[model samples]
Target: MKKILALVLALALVLSCASALAAKVGVSMPTKDLQRWNQDGEYMEKLLTEAGFEAELQYASNDVPTQLNQVETMIDDGCEVIVIAAIEGSSLGAALDKAAEKGVKVIAYDRLLMDNANVDYYATFDNFKVGVVQGEFVEKALDLANAAGPFTFEFTAGDPGDNNAGFFFNGAMSVLKKYIDEGKIVVTSGQTEFADVATPTWKTDVAQKRAEDILTANYADGKKIDAWVCSNDSTALGVTNALEDNYDVDTLGWPIITGQDCDIANTKNMIAGKQSMSVFKDTRTLAAQVVKMVGQILAGETVDVNDEETYNNNVKVVPSFLCDPVFANAENYKTILIDSGYYTEDQLQ
Candidate 1:
């Protein structure tokens, strides 16, 4: 009888220890307004929970102060790991300093947290490649290699505060700049600089307003925009909305617009022949990799990185694992998004 009691107590103690050791991980997202961030946060939470860890997910609604406060709260709540997709990459240095003081591990999720030594690892898709895919889509659709005349092109990039914005802009420009210089592509608005083309907050409404302004300034003379290389789906949606409202689609025809994130609305637009293509970064795959990385960190195993030199936060070079991104259009949305269970047909419809 004493032996049985002893065994019961021992089992209870083991269970308690296991519960205590289940480290809490905090995932901080920029905003829930964007479809991509919603998918990223939920996927990360689900994967972390399934991996025997506690997940604390927070959204900042595009506010930098709110994100910093949330990080402090997570730290107070005993989060051992903090994953942050910063609203502005450079705004989290002070908050991260506190996190580092507590010996908490930090992972920059999708968006690199810039100029902070507290960041331990970065997990993101190749942002430059995302732009390349967008540029290539335009090249193929316009038959730039074989076409005869010049095409009128415009650019729309993401928030200037976001570091990835530069990468996407540069990547697309790398492909299109030569054409622009050789007179194969022309920017009627003359808004070629990244600063001029940046859309604050990656807001669809801001992008729409900018598109309206661009159309008003450049196309009022009935000059048609042949292609619009928007950095992501939200911006693309804005451009599409502007064109649909301002231009006569029957005569002017829709431009070959590029986007990223494979957003459902944008995917549907692609299917309906409104938007041209979107760069699909599989958030599920990224979340799984991050979960695995967290597990390794907790287990005291070595974390792996494919990129050691590329991502510098102005303080130190962050070790990074860059996931590959692919472009999705009407032809392969079903195979890439639907068949892979990232979304269902009903969702896209």
Candidate 2:
């Protein structure tokens, strides 16, 4: 009896020691409404769990105050580290300050916060590169169509509140502007003409309505619109749906559409020639890298910011890890997303 009791006690001690070595991490994501974020959250959770750490995640749903309160709770719960996909950089100042006061490390995931305060680290894709790729694809697609007689193309941007959106827009615009300036692609009616850019939430319904309005007011008036440079998959769905159901858009040769986030539906559309291409940022690789960072931080080791890149916000330089972005069209769909086990062939089909 005495020997058994001693062995039990020893086992308990080992378990306790293991748990103590594992970090307690809290993750606050911007929104769960989008498919990519959902996958990101799930992947991160699984990775953290496998690393023997506890992960507490909160969805802001684009709500700043809610995220702030959640962070405060995490601090009170004695989290050692924090990962935030901030809804808005400006509103997260107080939460970050509290984390800093507690000496807890923070990582800005996918988007850089603008507060100018010290953010420990960031993990995301090369968003600017995503835009540039989209631009090049757009120009190529247009040229392939031999889109004759100089027609005006429409521009639809993401929500202006997201800093990443601006980066994406700017990246694509860098290539698009060159053509616009040289009279290759004309800018027709959009946020510029309406005096407020198309900064709608990532809702297909809203994008569809916007496209319907454009077709009704502009196309009906004898103005022939040519291509559409949609920012992401959801917006592309909206524009495509409007064109198909409302306006018989097939007659327009399915303008050069763009998207991101290799959602199953979007991938199918790309395969079927309904959409153009999407930027494929492997969430599995991203999740693994973040888990590795957390492991190092938990083990009382410092993050190696020397090799990581830095991006400036309003006040401070944010150390960031920019992962490579892969452009996926019909050619590399199976090789990139399917074979990597990000999703199954059946899910996409």
Which candidate achieves the best TM-score against the true structure? 1
| Alpha-carbon TM-score of each model against the true structure | 0.95, 0.88
Clashes of 1: 1
Per-residue lDDT for 1-349 in model 1, tens only?
9999999999999986586458899999999999999999998998888888999999998999999999999999999999999999999888899999999999999889998889999999999988988888898888897897599999999999898999999999988998999899999989999999999999999999999998987788788789999999999999999999877777988989999999989999999999989999999999999999988887788997899999998999999999999989999999999999989989987
After superposing candidate 2 on the true structure, give the runs of residues whose Cα lies further than 4 Å from its correct spot: 1-20, 144-151, 190-195, 221-224, 304-310
lDDT of each: 0.92, 0.77
lDDT of 2 at 215: 78
List clash counts for every candidate, in order.
1, 2
RMSD, every candidate, angstroms = 2.9, 4.4
Task: For model 1, give the 10-residue run with minimal summed lDDT.
Answer: 14-23
The C-alpha local distance difference test score for the whole of candidate 2 amounts to 0.77
